[model samples]
Target: MPIRRGSDIGSPARTRSRKKSRRLWTAGAIALSLPLGLTAAAQGNASSPFGDEPELLQYEEQFLTLYETIKDPANGYFSDEGIPYHSVETLIVEAPDHGHQTTSEAYSYLIWLEAQYGQVTGDWQPFNDSWALMEEWMIPSADEQPSNSFYDPSSPATYAPESTDPADYPAQMDPDVPVGEDPLADELSSTYGTDEIYGMHWLQDVDDTYGYGSACGGTAGDPTFINTFQRGPQESTWETVTHPSCDDFSFGGENGYLDLFTGDASYAQQWRYTNAPDADARAVQAAYWANQWASEQGNAAAVAGTVEKAAQMGDYLRYSMYDKYFKEIGDCVGPSECAAGSGKSSNHQLMSWYYAWGGALDTSAGWAWRIGASYAHFGYQNPMAAYVLSTDEALIPQSPSAGEDWGNSLDRMIEFYTWLQSAEGGIAGGATNSWEGDYGTPPAGTPTFYGMYYDEKPVYHDPPSNRWFGMQAWSMQRLAEYYYVSGDERVGPVLDKWADWVVGEVTIGEGGDFQIPAELEWSGAPDTWDPANPGDNAGLHVEVTAHSQDVGVTGSLANALSFYAAASGDTAAQETASGLLDALLANQDAQGIAVPETRGDYSRFGDEVYIPEGWSGTMPNGDVIEPGSTFSSIRSFYQEDENWPQVEAYLNGGDAPTFEYHRFWAQADIAIALATYTQLFGAEE
Candidate 1:
């Protein structure tokens, strides 16, 4: 049975505050002591934290209120389903299946908050309540099916919808509508449309391509692949969009990775669909911490069970994912084996990379020809994998009998990192030997899909993939954690290299703004705001710009760098983080509510529209132009309209802004960073 609120069962004996001096930091003191170029109203300072103790208390209270507001009381987690406001009051979820990470972050923050209170007041009340949350919501009971447990099985793979018929998708009101050139038909289908195990409840209306393009849901003109049946086995689903070569794997298995995806092929696909290792890494990390909490209470069973879960996740990441790739595909081969431009670690670098199942098939192995044609490793997914492995050796567990010892796991990470370090002092997110430059005459015996040979050079490989600063921030954070846990001096240099790059490339100057670079080059870059415009380095920083700068992405990096600076004594890294936090605070909406506006990277609904293809012309005032515009120059609704402020008003003690585009991550990341900063630096000293 699910644990209920007010239940005394999980509460630990309460104690008085351990460190009275640290109990509360006044915001007023922080405002006075803050260094130059820093904003007093942003996050609090390390010394005395948030200027006033009440501000910090208020921050916590507001967070809890928002958490309770958005949480699905039924399941005891934040709901990503339905309209954006209906779910979280702002920011609609483009893919509900992918929204679990945001919810996981929410829970993680709650635990952090409770832990903070526990450290400060010696009060176990908040800690006990938060721990109860995990038991009541995260853990699956004995009678519960593994599928019912939100935390047990990994994320379900998402499929492009196959139906275009309006009648078949009655769940979506106004299904047959069109947004400009893009038809709403593709929005109605799903990659899981053929699967029986997944019902309509699993597919949210906003799941399709965030309401863009015909390829989002299914083929616009083709009807052969329309989703007609729902209650069938694995055989009913289309393994590939058009490929006959795709084979089916046995549906059920004891393997975590296999079982999570294949056990129900009706709900599974040939490939893993999710991106970013944050969810997977954070889930295991939370489990580790939960085990620590359980151990403190002498709950041996809970401790063991949580550890086992964490280790299992590690096994899947290590053996099935990271290790398997490294062993099978070493870094790089000679030109005869690899493409022309292939280097030492190019092939084996990005262990965290992943694309949706059959996405490679859908794109016809568009980028990487030899290996990448089959595997579309992403840059954002692996740092957390490194984090999980480096978190604890117990979390590492024993490898398969045939597999090597646990130390090799860290060794693998070192190898991956060596490949990650670029000449420019930054870490690139992904690298592939798919291009002719990566591999000349493709390896023999390569698999074929959709009547296309994986050996041929594809147009997608001509221009190499660019690094993502957001992902690098994740890597930097992971590196910090790794240093903290392992106490390995080696990681410090790595941190310096990446941190230096961030300071030099991403930051405007010593006390200026932080900008995330777009994936494309100068002319083809995504549209975003440039703080340095009209100054010394005016006109959009293309080579060193990001899609958008927000608290979630930037604050995450700040937290990680803070940890690194603490561990490594890197003052430059610390200074950079301070500047970043200042920038984050300075970007708040009218209500002192800070968050990231949508950045232009992939989708362009609220961020930036593709010039002539999606829109055209300038405003009557010539202040805004659509076509031939860089992401920095384009104006978006997020920049102009979004500010709806119920949560902000409640938390910050002010009225809600008129606009609305809420992102829980922004709040969570900032809170996490602030808490970490307070813990590390807050004191009477």
Candidate 2:
């Protein structure tokens, strides 16, 4: 039997028993010798794709070494069920709030990693297996979301006013507030012949560490669907109250965890999921490369099924293009005053923060809801995936309108990037149709994109969403890829300026000691968008506030520079990219390339968690949740982690904890960077 099948049409049972031969190569060993498969023919003249250049060959060896380290069971990158964890360490906290927990972002990186591996080795099994694992574990099964058939298109979801303060929630769901219709529901269901969504949920408890168990009700220890970040724009991962996606009223307060985020007359056992569109788009981006590379090797058929599934995922990702409540796009102010949308009026045509859906757990309830996000972050846009979905015949979505939608999205995204570009060449935060996430009015003279208002920080405010330099690298890498593929004149200037700015900030010191921009500070905002004659954005600018040797961001930065160099023939970009890759090679370890990080944010471990007064609950492990609870008090699991002592000391007024983290996405990014360099510029003599 095939090792795994695609989940485009239907979900499949976990097929974790399949095994592939593993290559065992030490990082130190590979540095001294050529990678196993390279031959003289593979290293021919500059015209050859895989050149014999010593630096390129060394990068290939580095790629193989990182690949083996990631795949080696002893390295602990993968869980028992083959799902990749967010990071190898357990006590760390970031977007997912826990190191063991995984996100769709990590799954997408795994797919990208395997795709590069396939390109290098001509073996597609690992690529297929990674997608299968993502589908089996990250995407919820039919049983997990059994009532999607009950979803209504005309009325998507009730309006719940969002507040920046966590204390102000349980936001009441107001039925009187008008919401617009879902434009894609009927077509998507009809195209697939199933009401179920063919997308992965944004987050998952990979080890079932929170004890959410399976759909409806099941045992713990299996990978389970989970969610966080409910309170609003100001709610960071630190303030979130984690809960199961499939709440059965078995944990939390009387209404499970629902009442904590949204309030209604009553509540029922339910299942819900949020889709991070950027991650799904990246998976499609990876699949496009996989198909191109596989076809080059006369092995296109090996990954055809998975590519189809990626297209299916892209089809559903259209939900991210619409307004949160389908409100008419552009200058939508006031909740009731903002006219509800019809057809495509609500479409933002740019990738938003998230789209979500849910339904009652009871089979007979016949009620479900879906919602799109109103905020569009520049960092999440992927024109490369949009190009693939709109143009690739075999990879185009099945829905009749998907091609048109993605085509529009591709154009809109480029316009968005152009509009948001700052004087310093970095992209600004984003724009939103609903100001303050509630259709509130923006300050006077705030610039707008189409109808959406410019926001210095789009989604969350605790840590400004665009403050991380990693976002610039990730988004620009996609733009670079699109440029490499299309050579579109619109993208060339954006890449030129961005490459110059980022390359200026990168410092590759001797012996792999280097620093790239870490935290960024933005000043000024782009002028209102004018597609016919775009503004220079002379007033908008960015400053590098801090710098660090972030391994993952370095890899992504190198990837972006290489792609830009490949298309534009920028020697500066090409040299800097090669330098960054070479510097990273000096930091390799048994698990992966990484650097020590002093987590000063660990002090937030003691930060208070705002629970409603007179309301209390217990976690599955019997941790208490009440008004006085702090973040560390909730789960009580972190104290048991091997790295807990350092965090505990930091929480108890000691120096901040330092950890050498081996994040799955970081390892994958490093490997992909090496492979990308080999493919893009390796042939150069």
Candidate 3:
């Protein structure tokens, strides 16, 4: 039977979901019901021959095996044939934190799948289906938010929709909630004073309050961006409650990254109501939409949409780097910047060095070539582009203080970049920058690093989130990349800080026992806040939100281990990676639905659990791991059914010709470590 996801059922609707799932148990059912059959290449290419390589043949077999279980093109999201696609009517736990459009997720995965699987199956079906979300969200006019700069854009920074109303959501009524329940009321109960998974339900609240903008459902109040003084930290986190501007003018808030966070706490706090920066979400959704393109629908539109989203991503990235970073003047910061240029990393200043420091290989400056041709819209990857994505960059001393260069990328390179930022972060939240060092806690009302940045105090965080510091490995990693590529002198110490911090924060024993960070109270015991000491970094724990033992802490440490050990001349770093790797190895599942018997690198097999009634049931707090649990997020939503084939293919060397599958920072680190060992210690033999 289809393994029950959350609550022995699926989505938010509990009735008969499992029963319907049971019908399409066998892989054969999915292949027969959906579009897994031999799909002819477009036009005259239909007669093209199938795979000839052994790797291709192996990957193809795996893909065919997943014929069933994967979502069918029945007009809904990832599902098998005739499987009722969950709509607003049938929601999985109150919609998720930031995934107002999970289809974007489908699209993102689809892009990865196409790069990894399409060649094996000669299929564009999956990629096409993933992009289907464009039909509803990615439109010329619909893309822009009301009063957003893209729309009216009166002055330099002023945006008409500076403050959003909480009562409005999803434009109008949504079936996701109870039939007649007041969306505002429902959302209030969800995000209000809580950082639990349900807190994300605030997404709908923000959309209703603010109205969906161009960066439609991309990200909301992402902590990484929110913390930056560039955006002016003084703005009221709660759009409905306050409107305080540092500068005399508006901040074109609806555009760029501001629209990611929700004004209301009841909905998915990460559920971005606005959608101005449309590239990321759209590409992600296009990946999911690709699976459903098995029909006569040629996949052209989907591919084109995917390409378009990539283009937009490229443009936005350049805008962010050249224009936004170099030129923009905010209240807290001025137009003038560090003379060191790319060599700055103490704070959010890391963004400017994205060309050489940030892991922009996949999105920022080098996103185009890193992704593919359609992705070349970032003008094109020059010298620094390839450098950030690889060790070949020669390690420049862009930032003398931090050192290290070339972060991570999405080209199957590393998992740290992806997992460290979002693994424990829950599927519905915003991506974070880096983890907090020394396990410090934010003061009360100062926004706990749990997830959101503006709301720094865990006290203000009613329930408090666990996504932030938990997944901040990304920052350190990109810095290391910067050092490796740019040859910057600052990287040595910066790498040490990250490496040491990872070991200090996350440690594993002989067994799979993980030692998460527990900040020494000193003054602040359980809570990190202290009234006595003014401005002391009381306490912060990214582990606060990550409850699962799977990816949250483990994945981050693994990523840290990989990067720290990959270069550092220190034998201790290598030892740290080894110990962590051992624990990861112990958790491997041989017959797991996701990938094959994984040996060596753990990236091949991410966290994929087959809990019988675990997720399929209710939450301890009564809230379901709706939308999805952190477990699902780890594997990039990879499960045994259809997507696993590609995951397996990439993992087992069946598909990964180049170590590109090491695209994820964490995953790439593992690859880099292995490559290093092979060079020094020689092959395993």
lDDT of each: 0.34, 0.83, 0.25
Worst 10 residues of 1 by lDDT: 5-14
Best-performing candidate as measured by lDDT: 2
Candidate 3, residues 1-685: lDDT per residue as tens digits? Answer: 0000000000000001111110111110112122211112111222122234222122223333322222333323232211112221121111121212232222333344442233224356544443443333222121211122121111111011111222221112112221111111122223233211110000121121121221223333211111111111111121111111111112222222222222222221111121211224223222322322322235444355444443323222322122111221111111122111121211221112121001111112111000000001111112223232222112211222111222322221122122122122211122112112001232344321223122222111211222234323433443443344344443455456546655555555554554544211112212221234322222322333222233223444444444444444445654554454444434432211211122233232333322212123222122222222233232132243333555466655675322111111122122222222222212111
Number of clashes in every candidate structure? 41, 2, 146
In model 3, state the lDDT of residue 387.
Answer: 33
What stretches of model 3 exceed 4 Å from their correct place? 1-77, 80-312, 318-467, 518-553, 588-685
Q: TM-scores of the models, in the given order?
A: 0.50, 0.92, 0.37
Clashes of 1: 41
lDDT per residue as tens, model 1, 1-685? 0000000000000034344343222211111222322224334444322355443343343333333343334422344332221123333322221222223234444555454444443445554565455434332222211121121111111111112221221111121221011011121112212111110011111222211112223322211111111111111111101111111221112221122111222222222122223344554554554444444446535345445545654443331232111212432333233222211122232343321112121233221100111222223333434544554554654433212323444454554444334444554333233223222233454322211122211212212333234555655676666565456665667676667766665553222245754343322211121223211212212356435554566777778876666565566766666556556554544322344333221122222322223333332123344345533233222233233233224334543233233455444565556555554434442
lDDT, model 3? 0.25
Q: Is 2 or 3 the stronger prediction by TM-score?
A: 2
lDDT of 3 at 442: 27
